[model samples]
Target chain A: MELPGIAFYIVAFLTMGGIYAILCLALNMQWGFGGLFNAGIAGFYAVGAYTAAILTSAGSSAHLGGFDLPIVVGLICAGIASGIVGWAIARICVRLKADYLAMASIGIAEIIRLAIVNEEWLTNGSLGISRIPRPLEAFYSGRAAEVVFVVFVWLIVAVTFLVARRLQQSPWGRVMRAIRDNEETAASIGKDVQRFRTETFVVGSVFMGVAGALSAHYFKFFSPDATEPLLITFLAWVMLIAGGSGNNLGAIAGALAIWAIWSLTEVVTQQLPPDWATRSSYIRMLLIGLLLQFVLQRFRSGLFPEKSPKLRISREK
Target chain B: MIDFINFYLIPGITLGSIYALGAVGVSMIFGILRFAHFAHGDLMTVGAYAALTAVWVLGIPALAAIPFAIIVTCLAALLADRLFYRPLRDLPTIYTVIASFGVALILRSIVQTVWGTDSQVYMTGFQKPTIFFDTFRIATRHIQIILATAALTVALHYFLSRTRLGKSMRAVADDPDLAAVAGLDTERIIRWTWIIGAALAAIAGVFVGLDTDVHTNLGWNLLLPMFAAALLGGIGKPLGAIAGGLIIGIAEEACTYPFFGDTLIAPSYKSAVAFVIMVLILIYRPQGLFRGRLM
Candidate 1:
């Protein structure tokens, strides 16, 4: 089995890295900007992916497959659906204080995964939908197409980062920060805490949904198995936490760093002696766990701390 | 209908008992510590494996090995709390939550490294299935598990309500600062909390292993259900935890029944069923079914 070309691998890495960076950014917005600990982002991501796959797949009855909608539309639809779900969850759960919110989000995520698994009519059950259409297949060809798609995804990342940064600086951003820092004080200042949280959650989930859609198109195949809470969800959390939670750039950096590490470990394992290779996957998990522990212990602020806001003085006065 | 009741109801209760024991441990820890310990499931796995090792490798009797497993698990929990959790206790609650994940990862890795990823069954084979009249059948092992859980729950109730140490535990759960001011040794209470909670978790693990195959992922699978139970019973309430566990257990089993003709939900959806129940409870009554204090 010859390995794919280096360019192919690079494109794959960049695609995954970009998608994850988008997810981390979403999480950073919810967790860092809004101080919502969402343990269920993977659920939304999976939902987005499945929604796109089911809607766009060829030859399906009852479900909305065979539409062959443009990739941009599919991506947008994914974001809308996830945003709606996130809004519903927020409305129900935003009132609950910290820790309970985490538990609730985790519960919701598990439920979504179960729904994907059980709702055979809609999600194709455990067999999972495959042969998803690539977005730019008609316009571009071959590896160059892949390279273009990577750039396209990075463009999404760039826009998302810019938007998140803008939101973080706006008045609404200040309100969100205030809520994160102290809800009572924010409320005292006439802020609708729940509304802010709900909006933030919806917006963040939209990004997650878009990321999921992008990822599905890149992979060209998807399964309910991909949506399982443990693998994708936890890894994203690990990335956001490793980077500064509030910093979009840091989230991207962390995604790239972790994905590179993960890819490098996989490659290294494959090259190792056959006997050692078998256990390398478990070793990787252990290392990740250990890395999480070390990071949490040693640098609680993360590699890139969220920069303090710049203050301006009235020099004219 | 009678057959369905006989088949599913009793088995569900037995399963519920096991979950209740695990949830009780989780509730107690959360009540006192004020953070969700994600590693609790792995601790359950460790406990089950510890007992398995004692029986299979060390040649101890199954009955004797349980106590050993519980002790070992308790010690491990205590050590983890002291080394990993204690330092971060003063940090942000999120830090503790993250640390729990780390602890879970580390424990899982250790288990995999030592036991390998392959599933293990307790060496003790079934002696015989109990005959309950002519229509119903029950397993002797399950009967033992249910009875043992009841006994433990009762003992725990008495210990918490009647005994001096139990009162201290409750005091700490209510308000650690006040309890400390009241001259209760808060640190000792915490240590004992981990010990007892871990011991109960170990018992649940052993019971689960007896009922089904034991694997590294067993604890991980149990985590959500345990949380459901704890949340349903009202986060820090011990009795609520037990009740919540039983309810979730029965609900999970019953959900497997065919709702519409020829459309039966699979047992794999048990976790999902638990989550749904939990979400409804959370949405309507965030304080939980029992309305106990938040952990």
Candidate 2:
């Protein structure tokens, strides 16, 4: 017997793939471009999703569900809220280097998650907010709606990618790279390195927020459980590191490859014997670890290594 | 208030000793290797499992299994370092951190696969509750844990201060290159560091399991608290970790008591309490309370 409705499966896969692409790009800009080792991308993503959900869910006639703003507006608000949170964290913790920065960001992310979990009045706690208004609910429904959502998401991804590319080539991007390569040199050139770092952090985080908002709308639900670090944060890190840290396209490629492999593994595992299928999920985690080790060993520079501006421009020319 | 002290304070000290032991291993690894070993928690879990396995499968006594578990864990640590870490020694510290995370995931998966996901209680017929007074009662297991933690801490302090190898480890932590130049065997020191730290972690894990139940997520859940304690005490300072752990543990418990009949603070906020304390300490004194060497 074959699984039915393969079309739905394909659409779902692409939809998830597109959202992850956006998430990876956002992480790429922060870690790849700015050399900020943020371990809290999931926190920001959750913040955006919850922010939109909460804002739109408030003032409703039934169980805090009424404000009813447009999906685009909610998305924008999510971006702004996440940007603000990112900016605040950067301001406080950006002065530290690798290990300290990682610890601080992880701590901040945990705090964000805990706040979301405990602040039942605001977040509705673990029960989660549901019945979120879909964009273009009147015009599109079912598979057609999913297709339209995917297109809209890809549109956002394209716009964000272009903007990020432009920014990376700009004078500001050069200064950011300069700081990443050599902080002392950047400071010697009279660049306010901390401010630039914070700005890059906020901008990158805004993209993550936007991606989260898109995901929330697609799912039409939001929960504190979704904000946990293990779910989204590490996956994004793996994608970025596996693909190529400093390259946006590499991030997208990494996202797609890893997710596809993950999904395919799940599908294949379901076909195994009962005992084997039961243990396969654990084995899959081991495989992911082994895959990471393998990737680190063979392609330390990642799949699509960061290209110099001269090479990139030449290719374009 | 007196009842509160008898109940919360004493129990907090018992719990804190376990946290302190775990933190010492984490802090030492961070000190020498210069990376947050996310796998440290899983190492502890593995140690607890080792002890549990020794008791259940090998028919060893719980007390006897503790030392054996520690030794096995030390060997495991050495193997991990040799296999995974030694190869990446030349890379950036961040790479090591990521690799440690990979190691953690692998260890967790392996444990789950072999033992299944059920919580394991290592009850080697060693269940006795000790009563201190009419109002105060403590588990004999907890008292044993506290005593063992004290003994281990004292032994570790002596070893670090008086032993030549321990001095060499400190030197390596200070500067690997300088230690190498000063005729210290850097590789040997690092191996010893892993052995000692992992052994300590094993002891802590077994002690914790004796008092509670051993579960897969036990180590992962303890990770943040370990970090908090290590950071609160200077990261590399073992004694400071003890003090930091006690302070955090007591504060977490104390905060949960209802003040003047107002709504009692939820116990779920325990992690938040530790986190808040950690953030405050970091903001005020990023170097930590004891202000020892950067680790």
TM-score of chain A of each: 0.92, 0.92
lDDT per residue (tens digit) for residues A1-317 in model 1: 34567768888899989999999999988988888878777888987887778666666664447567777788889999999989888888788766777777777777887787788778777777777887668788888888889999999999999999988887788889889888999999799999999999899999999888887888777776654456577678778878878787789988888888878888877887887777777777777777777777776677788885664545885
Writing each residue's lDDT as its tens digit, candidate 1 over B229-288 gives 998998778899999999988888777866565425677767777778777877888778
lDDT tens digits, residue span B93-202, model 2: 77888777778888888888887889888774656567666666777877887788888888988988999998887777667788889998777778887888788788
DockQ for model 1 equals 0.60
Q: Against the correct fold, how does model 2 do in TM-score?
A: 0.93
Candidate 2 docks at the CAPRI level of medium
Stretches of model 2 off by over 4 angstroms after superposition: A1-4, A57-66, A225-228, A311-317, B59-63, B124-128, B133-135, B259-265
lDDT tens per residue, model 2, A1-317: 33647877877888888888889999888888888877778888888888778666546433344467777888888999999988887876667566666666767777788777787777777877887766677898987998888788888888888978887888888888999899999999899989999999999999999888887888888886654456477678777789998887898899888888878889888898998877888887788777777776677778899875652444544
Question: Which pairs clash (backbone N, Cα, C closer than 3 Å) in model 2?
Answer: A60-A66
Q: Give residue A67's lDDT in candidate 1 (0 to 100).
A: 68
Candidate RMSDs in order? 2.7, 3.1
Per-residue error for A73 in candidate 1, Å, reads 0.8
